[model samples]
Target: MLSLVDSGSGTVVGRAEGEDIVLDVHTSGSGPALVLLHGAEGREANDAFIAALAERFTVIAPSHPGFGLSPRPDWCDSVEDLAYLYLEWLERQDWHDTMLVGLQFGGWVAAEMAVRDCSRLGRLTLVDPVGIKVGGREDRDISDVFAISRSELDARHYADPAAGPGDLSQASRDDVLHIARNEEALALYGWEPYLHNPRLQRWLHRIHVPTLVTWGAQDGVVSPDYGRAYADAIPGARFELVGEAGHRAQIEQPDTLAKLIAEHSA
Candidate 1:
């Protein structure tokens, strides 16, 4: 049985496990079920987005193993593993008419899941997702996020770099640790194939659920063109561009992104 405890912060923390793996899940609100998959920056980075989503739907957000306070099992390493794990978790929850939304890395995970089994999902939204290769072997569709300087990364990640996380020197200890953990986990999973699954593009057509792919209009990490390709790969998926935002559209424009998601899922 899954064990949930009150986190005293309006969110309930639950442990969802499959075999030896356990995921730290944060849940809140009440309405139709909406499972949110967070980006490489981890769960805390999407706090505002989650709160906005919670207002309309019961938000079930899980910290991928190795992110936040979740422990990563030795055998679990890739996004594919996370996809299967979350799929099992969804089955265990037995939620119907669920909306699955993925942001950045989490978007990749959600796509992987839907391509495998979308039986319980009613809708899917991928925001600035990175999981498929749409460019030639010599072309780079996604930017090298790690290689870039913090200033450069911020500029690429947020439409208004001034609005990005400023002056890390003032960050709390917990915040620093969370950031470090996120970076480590992201590199571990995305380093080899450079964030795109070699086979995911071939299987995207397997996803038949009503899908929406949203991208930051000014996204430099992965251009809007890449987002278009992502939408085109899935059957009947629509694409939209969130203006005045970069790669992290949910962070840059939570209300706008939330509205788009709410309308689509509704």
Candidate 2:
């Protein structure tokens, strides 16, 4: 069983035998429960987006273990572990009919969770998610984010690179540290598989809840076609595109993304 304790720092510490997983969870607003799973960059970039979602439903956003202030447990390594951890957390909270939204890497985690069990989830939304290989061995469906230059990455990640977050040189010390931590954790979970699970596509059919897979119209990282394929694999899943946005739609076009999510969950 997982036990949660308030850490007095706006974060929740979850404990389970021999493992202490500290999750930095941010909660706001009131109504139906809506959980937002952030991208590899962590939750710092989604403040405006979360606030918008909060207007319609109570928003619960948590930094994945190893991101932000959450420390990665030695025994917990894979995305599947993260998925099960969140599932247990949800069960403990007794939240029913919850709307689960995931961005980028978090979307992958959410997908893994839904495939295993979505009884507590009423709806699912994936924005520019990366998981499951839809191509042959020689094909690269997702961009190599880790190997690319910052400028090249920004070019691929944003419809208009200038509109996205500026270079890391200009970021605050705290922001830089947060980003570094996120990158390290992301590499640990996704590097070996190159950001995809060879088996996830096979189990996507197990997700019974309504799912919406959204991609940026100009996404260079995963392409709109990849998004469509992802949506098609899941029974009854719908695919939509956000105009003038790239991989990180929540950051590049928060208002449009928020509107889409609100409508979908409604």
Please name the candidate that would achieve the greatest TM-score relative to the true structure. Answer: 2
TM, every model: 0.92, 0.94
Error of 1 at 230 (Å): 0.3
- lDDT string, candidate 1, 150-177, tens digits: 7898899999997677667887777777
Q: Residue 6 in candidate 1 has what lDDT?
A: 26
Once fitted onto the true fold, the runs of candidate 2 whose alpha carbons sit more than 4 angstroms away are 1-13
Give lDDT: candidate 1, residue 190: 90
lDDT digits (tens) for residues 53-95 of candidate 2: 8889999999888887766677778999889999988888888
Q: Which portions of model 1 miss their true places by more than 4 Å? A: 1-20
RMSD to the true structure for each prediction, in A, is 3.9, 3.4
